[model samples]
Target: MARRRDLHPEEQALWQAVASTVTPNIRHRAKTVLPAAQPAISPVDPPPVPPKLPAFRLGEKLPPKSVRPAESPLRMDAKTHARMTRGKLAPEARIDLHGMTLAEAHGELIHFILGAQEQGHRLVLVITGKGKPGREDDHLHRQGGVLRQQVPHWLRLPPLGLAVQQVAEAHLRHGGSGACYVYLRRR
Candidate 1:
């Protein structure tokens, strides 16, 4: 095989410019740099291990006794409700649960609400797409709107329930029937 020739200075410069403009892989692990000086601690001593955090498992059920009864849906004063209705109170963060299965949405809702509370966010929006219209089958049976119904129930379950203070349907601009605003309790 023939050896490849080096690029001309102009070509090299152009290539450098193009490469600089392209974003580097964010997930690429960075090289670790060790310090020249070693710590005075004895070599026999082991490094301290950090405490393990409790892991959240999807679909794990909490003991019914441990979970508090679902609180009545929060009701704000007319002034506050009016403010929310008029879009005066904007959400600090938003999560869209569209296309997610019930289990997936439940897990995500738990994480989002807890995170928002930890961050001291007072309000956030959770978008659960208004499900496809129910088909006309038996007059007694209407289906769809699963997430719409289940979200409130999930919010009132164990860990997530503790984090949220209230929930209300969003204003038309934020996705009316398709979304709800979650009001998180202060940490």
Candidate 2:
């Protein structure tokens, strides 16, 4: 409990002077009931109050935020992309990441994409096999397999992103959500 100290004579005198100058806004002011007596204790400094923040307006738009560098936007020809996704164009080479851990898959993927690009292969298949269901941390997370979720990100990031031109989800015939189609850049 906080103990109220008796006011200093100088402070009391100043307060009286200020109180005398103020007129009550309401002529019929309600009488203030005094608090019950409290036990005395050493005075502690009070914490400072913070200033109020401005309220947000309804439907106000926020300032635009910087965006992350997303994968290169659809640089391949539309017709080729359509044909590839439709499984009409078969991948020249493919790599299955079904059983590999993240590290192994990443290394193999770098090798595969770079090799395909070196060999002048335009499109290649990367089978991630949609992740497992109901399980929390097996391979990773998502509708497809654990590798399925990470393959695209790895392709979009360093080392692989430079070698790859475009990455799209596989068609049902090719493996659907379980896999991706990686289009390699020309060497």
Candidate 3:
């Protein structure tokens, strides 16, 4: 068991060569535990950055400040327009053209105003009966309202306003908010 002569010369030579060479490769392999790491990442992409937006300015006057705007033009809201018509009047002759075709109503309204002016009538009533009595689902028909909705727009026209001085919704006694009374300036 302790005989030095038992070792083969070729085996000893091979063992020595393998032991010396194996370590360099082993040390190298151990050093690379994590397979070659990638380069550190940059926050931004390369080149081609976007242009910055303009910042908002402070304390600038809005549209009304620069140019004078018109005053409160309408007297009533859309919902209340229907009720404003059937009210009281100040001796103005009123016309009700509700439910009529646009052409028919417009023609008649213009003709009536012109005739009123010729006859020296100052105040006039126009009742464009509220649109087709309301829809079944709308539930507005139970109120029995006047056609207050359409009158304001009709009166605002340059062609129509030329015949009148001032126009407003009538009091409840006259037609009670569903109708509008047109006041024509005595031409």
Cα RMSD for candidates in order: 22.5, 18.7, 26.0
Model 2, stretches more than 4 Å misplaced?
1-72, 136-142
Can you write out model 2's per-residue Cα lDDT over 1-187, one digit (the tens) per residue?
A: 9987766668766766765676654545545432234223223344587985434456865322211112348888999988987889998899888889989998999898888888999989888775567343222332435566567778888888899888877778988767778888888
TM-scores of all predicted structures: 0.56, 0.58, 0.44
Taking the tens digit of each residue's C-alpha lDDT, what string does model 1 give over 1-187? 9976666668766765765576544356344332224222222334578986333357754322211112344455677666776778888999999888889988898888888888888879888877776655321113346777678778878988778777777888888867877777778
- List clashing residue pairs in candidate 2: 130-144, 130-145, 130-178, 131-144, 131-145
lDDT score, candidate 2: 0.71
What tens digits encode model 3's per-residue C-alpha lDDT throughout 1-187? Answer: 7844444667656655655565344323333221123222223234566885333346632212111011225444444334433442355476777667667877888888888988998667766554445554443332343234435556667677677666665565655445556767657
Q: What's the lDDT of the predicted structure labeled candidate 1?
A: 0.68
> What's the true lDDT of residue 95 in model 3?
79
Give the C-alpha miss distance for residue 92 in model 3, angstroms: 3.7
Model 3, TM vs. native? 0.44
Candidate ranking under lDDT, highest first, comes to 2, 1, 3
Best model number under lDDT: 2
Task: Give me the displacement of residue 147 in model 1, in angstroms.
Answer: 1.0
